[model samples]
Target: MKNLIAATYAPMHTDGSLNTDKIKDYSQFLTKNNVSGVFMNGSTGDFTSLTIDERKAITLAWSENKSKDLYLIDHVGDPSLKVAKELAQYASDKVDAIAAIAPFYFRLNSIDKLIDYCKEIAICAPNLPFYYYHIPVLSGAQLNMASFLEQAKDNIPNLAGIKFTNNDLIDYGHCKSKANSKYNILFGYDELFINSLPLGATGWVGSTYNHLAPLYYKIKELFENGNMEAAADLQSKAIKFVELLNSKGGFNGVGKGFMRVLGVDCGPSRFPHTTLSDSDYIEIKEALDGIGLKSWFSK
Candidate 1:
């Protein structure tokens, strides 16, 4: 299987309900822009705010509109094993692969515990290719390369690969070095695509791709075509934009702002993440205008 360059996040209405139409529109938007895949309802997608049914609806919407040329990776992470399994089953026929984070909100003290969690999910959907979503900062599960291999190498047969989100290049390199050729290691940071690819990261997953697919695909194209300098330059520009967004706030606010600017009708994030301030909007607009990306917002 080819390594997938993917984006993760959920699309919600102003009322905090899953916006099925917007989800379909976003999926079509990504496919049109040549994104290899899209992962729905992950951490970036605001999984914590969505009910299991809502998550399934978003997945189904994506599956319905995604072209034959594109792939879909559903993020089915839930604190409840039963809910996670139910979502996995619901997405089985809808996505190319299924991924889930280790049950978060509770500390998984040992690697074995994490492995067991994966195994249970794998059993739930035996035919699906299961990818491990590793974002320790949010999951409260600390998994190094050694512990991962030791625990999962034998038991989780359907373990296709990992979505490594931590900013540790050393750990990423270690995982790449240890991973068999069959396993895919996708980078989770949008800003580190340049460095991550050269270090054997085969794919990427990030929040920004929802608004900037063209730039991301261009960077990937440059790297795959052996033009490191050009790729680095593009990555630098992308990093600047990411820094601008982070400066405004974190992903929830900035990402919502981006969708609004793009006219995608994604609406605001749920409570705990309010609408962007006037200053924040100006900052985002100025940055986009400076980068000649104002067209993305133009109706």
Candidate 2:
């Protein structure tokens, strides 16, 4: 739960089947860019569209290419608790850590229910650190995260921290102060990385980090050097990167294609997420250049 962790894309074949062969190169690419960790089988990965077996395959591929410098965090969340537990068990031995988003379909309205759900999955991977992926937008469980940490601390033994994707800075502050700043609250909102620094965010997990690691590292450096204005400007540029890609169909699909521009060749995204043609990528890159983001692209 330190430094930038890319919520990785699940590489696919043209037929929309899992192309795990690309993962070795994907891992190498992230490491080359100095992205310290990978959060696979999560939203950026289109986990909801993939089968349990497919999700497991993604984890295995990453595990095989695992490096000391690049740690792996497999997101084992599923609407089905059984499936989540199964994925957790499968990932337990393979990854450095594991995370689970709340059951998105049914939705856990109460904190206790969420803790119970996490508790079950945590026990499956008792040895590995557990992270609760608190992305309320997609999960639909907008319960207070601070309250969750207060309650879950005692019940869940392996509870390391939360991937706080929500934008509620007040609640994020409360979560950071909880247990005397004990839990590793890895901020998940890419656009708000600078904002989180004031609240003491040492770790981050985001899709944008996949493309702009150096930019973010620079942002952090500027902020630490007491250059708030420059940090804000760079953060604005990073946000523009997201907005630019999102303008082309949707960011999820378009962003995956941008990976190819970085030389990973993750192939195309699945249905509902618009897959861009080669010409479309050219247009997208041109658009990025127009916004002055070409220099920030992950190396």
Candidate 3:
């Protein structure tokens, strides 16, 4: 709720089990590092690969270890409305807000259906702030800003804002144009933080922020102080780091590899998600070392 600069979770285990201790450790690590918030059980967290119990365990662990200063955004996004509702209920008191993706896999061609789906989830967690996640590319739901705004105004009260992850800046700009000034628009793409901040985005939410929070904090401070050139330079470095990670297979492998390199020991990603090659690990180590972030690799 308080200007969220959040990190999405990296699934902590390869067996598709919730590593509660690791989650607690990671949550505390984020808290200590000054991250404003966290989005648990999200795309980077491999929510689809996890069982309901695993998701619940991760949420509960985070809740238990979470500092009052750290905001928790529980991503209760499952294809099943019932499971999502139940998870939301379970997380109601623990997290600051609850968010969900539009039901995916099945094509809901109409905006009406999408609105209805969101409304239903809203109904389930009336007390918690509900952020609608708009990642159309992965979810296969094209959310038109106009229609969503119109529907949300009429139907939902707890609908606080959106976590817009689309790569298209035009789509983000459109949403900003239509969205009320009070609504919090969180940019899910880490690389767009500097660009998005000027466009009325309240904060950022991304996997990279989990390990690179210090850099983001510095970048945000620079941007806020009107040092665009310095901010851009830092953002460029961050983007280059992310691009390097992506080249090794994006979040699944590289994200976990980053945690491992940082001595977090998060273990491997679930299968179907490839592990980092030995060469990939070496490349990552070299990148971290070049940045003088070698301390992260030391256990």
Candidate 4:
């Protein structure tokens, strides 16, 4: 769990259907790239766009490839608590862990409401570790996470920790210190990877890990060797990777297409995400090469 975990993409066919068949190859690709685990049905996986059955199918597909090396975590968060519980139950035995975000449609106004929501869903998968996906920007549940952990520790039985996605380092620092430093607070803001290291972040979950696992490992290596300057330089290069893809379209859409360039054809993204053409990849590859990133791409 100290290694990078990839927030995977939902592979789709040309007709925009689930391509579960591709998941086996996708798993192998992640393993080859040295990604230690996967956060499936996550934001990067486009969980909102997928049906409950499709999300269940993804959990099942990834389960087949689950090994000691490649951990699997299913994001079963839906606006409907009933639906979230169902998905969590479905993934309980299949995945290594389960995570859920606060109800996005009707946001939880208070920390107590958020805790109650997590408690209900966490119980459905009582046997598995539960993680709160705290991406307030998207979920609109901007409650302080440190406070949530303090109160939630007594309420939720299997509360492992949080997937802290927000950029608020102050809140993150507080969350990290809660419960006498017991919770497994996985840092989610990838662009600020270096910012997290000084505060003692060992594990990470992000979309960029899918493309640049080696690059991140290099960044960590440089940082640990007391070379702050080189580490920051490499970190900038990683951010450039995100910015470059985001420039083409949204990072979620364009970044998925770049997987094909790495030899794992994840196919096109679903509706509302841009699908790149062969020419687009050609240009993308050339631009990335110009930025000195080609040599650092995941193997």
Measured by lDDT, the strongest candidate is 2
Candidate 4 residues 1-299, lDDT tens each?
56899999998887888888999899988999889999999999999999999999999999997877898989999999999999999998999899999998888899989999999999999999999999999999989999999899889989998999999999998888774657889999999999999988888999999999998998899889999998998899999999989999889999999999998888889879889899999999999999899899986
TM-score of every prediction relative to native: 0.89, 0.98, 0.89, 0.98
Per-residue lDDT of 19-63 in model 1, one digit per residue for the tens?
A: 787776666666666667787788767788877777878888888
lDDT of 3 by residue, 1-299 (tens): 54445555554656645567787667667767777888888888878878898888888888887888788899997788888888888888888898999889785677788778888887777898889888888888886755676678777788888888877788788777777675777888887888887776767888777777777777778888999998888788777777777777765667766776665767777766767766778778797568655442223
| Residues 20-93 of candidate 2: C-alpha lDDT, one tens digit per residue | 99988888888999999999999999999898889989999999999998989999999999999999999988
Better of 1 and 2 by lDDT: 2
Alpha-carbon shift of residue 239 in model 2 (angstroms): 1.1
Per-residue error for 251 in candidate 2, Å, reads 0.8
Alpha-carbon runs more than 4 Å astray in model 1: 1-4, 224-230, 277-283, 291-299
Error at 5, model 4, angstroms: 0.6
Clashes in model 3: which pairs? none
Report the lDDT of model 4 for residue 85.
Answer: 97
**Where's the lowest-lDDT run of ten residues in candidate 4?**
174-183
In model 1, what are the clashing residue pairs, if there are any? 9-45, 10-45
Full-model lDDT for every candidate: 0.76, 0.92, 0.76, 0.92
Q: For model 3, give the 10-residue run with minimal summed lDDT.
A: 290-299
Of 3 and 4, the candidate ranking higher by TM-score: 4
Q: Give candidate 4 regions above 4 Å deviation.
A: 179-181
Query: Residue 38, candidate 4: how far off, in angstroms?
Result: 0.5
